[model samples]
Target: MLITQPSDLDPASPGPITIAQPLLDHLAAIRADVLASLASGEPVYGVNTGMGALSKVRLTTDEQKVHQRNLLLGRAVGGPPWLPDDEARAVLIGRLRTFLTGDAGVSVELIQQLVAFINSGHVPAIPAGGAGSAGEIIPLAHAFGPLAADLGPKEGIALLAGIPGATGRAALHAARARRLADRLSEIGAGAIAVIGANRGPYHPLTARGDDVLAAELTRLRNLVGPEPDPRSLQAPVSFRVAGPVIAHVRRTLTHLEAAVERAFTGVTDSPAYLDGEFVGTAGFHGIDLAAHCDHLTAALAHAAEVSTARLHRLLDPAVTGLPAQLAHEPGPQAGLVAVHKRAVATSHALRRLTLPSAIGTAETSNGQEDVQSFSWEAVGGLAEAIRLAREVAACELLAVHQALALSKRPVPPGLQELLLAVANVVPPIEADRPFGEDLTRLLDSVL
Candidate 1:
């Protein structure tokens, strides 16, 4: 709970920062390397250096501060009007990380200031948009601008280092779309585990899975409690035909998790100048952080598709055995049948966000910028997808809980705990509660 460094970025951690002494040391080591390179006068790129396009330009000792200041300032360009505290905090953490990597030359004192700022809750202003994921310098602009008058050494890259807000908004959310989508996917799985829609679709040996699958299936059932009116799905619906759908979604969540892990832990770096002497590493290199991200998107997309399909099955009067809308009154009430439509729409919206971003590399940067990953875009897409998945989960969890209630029969032990928790939160449909409000709350819980 006394999180003090970016290294402590657990899901439960408030945002993108945790600024501890160890992380500061790691960052300081990077700075030391940069300074050592500069002191050696070894023509190190940024340290004794010239920047982009001017990779050949070397600076005099007298101009070092000016050079560093200019570099930092450029990174601060192009951001939106306002950003949330969490995102600003994320930017601070990213800027600190970049400087720590020795990739950017910054004083350790600045890192300390950032740590204090975060701990004291004095986050700066960051714009919402203007970053395409290759970098988020604009927000970094917001991050460091005020601290350094919106312009300083290595400022340009700093502005682009961290992402915008961590949450999903319609247009301006950051590159976390995939992580959000992964979250949504897991919630979808959780909803499925507790709800008795179609276990038959995912029987382990029935499809293609190993001992792990068997274990996961057992774990899934145990977590949820049990199927209500288990008799209805005792055959193919419960454990037979549903195999394909369940297997497909589980596979997707696993993939999505892999992607988020990569994003969280992956290090993307580039030679401020790719002299090839230093390998001028293009974090924008052969590695596809974006590709991995896109893979996650594809998985989440599959999860959304399958979950929505299951939702469809629940809505079908012929399938779930619930009154048309899981409502006793049906036609008069509009029931959850309409909510199912919204869920499908939400899933589709998430799917739409999954379109790959790395495909469209910027054609030219004065012949210098050959390819751009637009990684921010890819991350952003997955983040949006995750949010959509959450909405779908809200729909699914609610739908199943209602169905179980109507059955008035003992739900299978596998789904009992989660079902009861859900039931307690919203209860089996009382008279016409505003489901939208309830949905918002449900998603907040899972996502």
Candidate 2:
């Protein structure tokens, strides 16, 4: 894609990337200005002067020539646990956004090379761990350092600066979470139908005041079709509260999406060039992205909590009015008792990951760079949370399908297709052959 602005970038797509011509021309102009500033013996941070604590110290012309490449070498301290190619592409794209405003003082050639690297499908070995720097120097160095040769005055600082790593990963996760939320709609509807839950909570009146809730309510009603006779006056809390919980996930997803847009559009290079001056900036700090990732993590956990609880309720003969454990017979068959254990374990792990990563900060870099944001860790946690959430959703799907099969109640026409699909992979729990295999197959079928 030829990206001219932040809105042009799609987090879900990792196709070939190209910079817009206007931005390239802008980069050329900025590079010329940087050369002029260097010619006049002006001290540009990370160019003619030492970096960080040594910023006050000046360098000779020879040292200046080699400093840019050395900067990369010195900070490539992290190892192993690399980002996947798509994520690496997003990070490079995010880095390209930093240069789009012409504040990074890098040559158009350097930008073109970076774009070529992304388009070429070259995955920079950026460590997923060791995001301990106040800024992104450690991971950025590992990412762009290989391309650091022949760099210009401020190019190294341009490459070393910014939260592209965190923001890019967050953008990808936000997209994944959105898809998971969509899938959960189908699963939630299936569960409601199987249990003959009241549609009163999803009535049009309750959807008022929140657009996400309204949309989810509509989706549920469509998937569930006309409601059956209520199993009771009210279904369990997990079923009744699903609309709002999913709305909360969607709401926090909006927050993450907004933060990602801001990160890509805004200038994030430290010591950014502005109107012929090299000025220091804190745009590299990524607490905004980290905090929003944390929020989404928490939201997914809430959704999972509801999902697992609903799964447990599905097993209750009292709730579904089916045989205990959704089994063919209570005494001889184990039914889905084992699946609930896996969901419980997965739910516990998901909850443990909800701790705010942004709050787990510390100082580093001899006080020159301190107060780390732990943005990378937050994005990583969000990725794992999404994984676990999907697992929980898969477990719910198994229960829903099993409950639908066991119940004598009429299945909604809207849910018939879903039931057929699930039943194909997960056969009826006729005699309780290993259900772990069923869950694995169901995950493949549904997810």
Candidate 3:
């Protein structure tokens, strides 16, 4: 769908992107205001005078155009093949929003034209790992590739302020990963439910069952199944907590979903000229989105940990109430013993990846860059967290399936459907099966 448009932005989740009108409207307004101020010979910081160290110097009316034009031309020093599709769109739209308020003095048509280029798929190549301080100066160089030829006084600074390009790519990656985490937790929780293992930490209940308790209970009954399976007795309690565990993961997805929506449609602005007034504020800062992404990343990683713990329980005969690793004979066959090691390692690694990026900062770039939202880092980490979670979920599904098979008994009523769903694709293990092949089929339904 065309994410740039309001209609398109409404239904979408998150990922790569494009731009739409609010961005254009923003740019047009900024351009007109700057021009009007220039035409009136009013002394403004960027629109009429030199910038940075040179801001005190005033420009003549004719020189104002020269200065604005020169700012775009000279700062056009942005080196690149160009920015990636998603980042470019983010930058373009982000930059457009800045000017749209008429503070930056950028032309409306110019902003519209840039969005047009994006819609047409004219992606400029941008490099990775350009982590400079001072509001993503290096990344902005690549981000501004499209509008290189035309810039205003503070326009370049506005465009470069806080590398939203990197942030965009990171946001997209985080969103995709969080969804995978969601699915992983659901299937992982499902496996836990199948085994009936004792609950550990994460609960669906808040301290006050005031809002989500009933809602979660309703969801539990609706999604988990009607009765427990007897074969599922091998790991009795696993299927029960699946509801709340899955619910925790569900909350994370809800946040990621909102983040993705904003990836294309968010208008971060401060000092924006809304309607007819110059409204100065902090919308330009993306701390809110970064925080949301950070929270999701951390929560999803925990979800992975919860699932991995459940997979380990499958190996404990006392835990699963069945053969170790759900082995058929229990003595000779290794069963799921080694399989769980993978799950444990994967979960640990994902948890490590969950370290919040929003708090990351450094004093660099000649001290021009200090604290940072680290939004890009946060989003980038999310994708990794998501992938690891999928692997972990696959492990749980296999473990649960194996535990049920070794029961040598009927499956629990509630777990029966989930088991059938698994068995529909996976054959019972005899001596040993190709682990990879078994994992692949097992994950077909869950992962």
Candidate 4:
């Protein structure tokens, strides 16, 4: 697809190979405006003057070009563990989307080069850490430094302005998390039915006016098929509140989608040319996306907690009406006891990752850059949280399948289908054996 607007950029969508003509026109117009402003002897922040704490220092026309090159080279301080190829591709796409808004004042040639970079499958070596600036200067610089020779007046700051690294990473994580959230709903419903949980908590009457909750109820109904008699008067809170918990994660994904869309479409360059004048603003701030990432982390943590609790319920004989740890024999062989312990550790680690990274700030760039949005860190934490949540969900699914097998009760058609799918990769746990590969295979098959 041709790159033109924010909606065109999806994490799962293929990268664009060509730039739209309208975007090219906008870039030309912006470049003309920038040149005219410089010719008028107006002292722009990055065009004619030094950046950050040195903004007071005036630069001659000849020195201004050199300054732009230096900006890219000087800011390339990203550390080890380069971003993955897919993530780097996302960052490049995000950066190109920002330029399409025509606020960056970059030349058409520079935009074409970026497109060519993506088309050629050349992933920039951007580090996964050390982005502490007000804007994503360190990572952006590393991603764009190779093209410094092509940078024009004021283009360096424009290139570094938008929070592409954080925004792109967040977009990728949000897409994956959203897909996993939906699959979790299906798997969770199967688990609930296997344990004979009360259906009142997921009844339509319980779904207030929230659309997400209503939709979750419908999905639960489809997966659970028909409600059996309640095993206990009231199921555990984890089982009862599963619908609400998944609803919360769905809400967070909606907010993140909006935030990421804005990051792609909005003009975030400094010294934006608006209303026939260059105005300095905080368009580069990444708090909008940072806060959304933090919320995603919290939502994933809650899901992990619920999954862990459900796994615990499946292992208890009193709760599941099965042998301890779903063991074929009570005490002769250890069944899924070790798997439950691993789920516990995974959930606890995810809970620890729920701390918001936006709150951690420090003064840098000689105190000129204060109150940073640690958005990159927040997205990184969210990625880890998603991984742990998936692992926890995998454990819950394994336990639920085993519990259903031990009960020897007739299951809903939906749950029976799920069991058959799981059985394809993971056999019934007859005796104690290494289940590490089984867990991985189950997660891959279902999620």
- Steric overlap count per candidate: 64, 0, 38, 0
Cα RMSDs of all predictions? Answer: 5.3, 2.0, 5.6, 1.9
Candidate 3 has an lDDT of 0.56
**Which residue pairs clash in candidate 2?**
none
lDDT of 3 at 389: 70
Among these predicted structures, which one has the highest lDDT?
Answer: 2
User: What C-alpha lDDT do the candidate models reach, one value each?
Assistant: 0.53, 0.84, 0.56, 0.83
Rank order by lDDT, top first?
A: 2, 4, 3, 1
Lowest lDDT 10-residue stretch of candidate 2: 5-14
Q: What is the RMSD, in Å, between candidate 2 and the native fold over all Cα?
A: 2.0
Q: Which tens-of-lDDT digit does each residue in 219-254 have in candidate 1?
A: 444544444444354432322323333344455545
Q: What is the overall TM-score of model 3 with all chains considered together?
A: 0.71
lDDT of 3 at 307: 72
Ranking by TM-score: 4, 2, 1, 3
- Residue 92, candidate 3: C-alpha displacement in angstroms: 5.6
Query: In candidate 2, what are the lDDT values of residues 375-403, reduced to their tens digit?
Result: 88888899889989999998898888778
Evaluate model 1: give its TM-score: 0.76
Residue 14 miss distance in model 1 (angstroms): 3.5
**If both were scored by TM-score, which would come out higher, candidate 1 or candidate 3?**
1
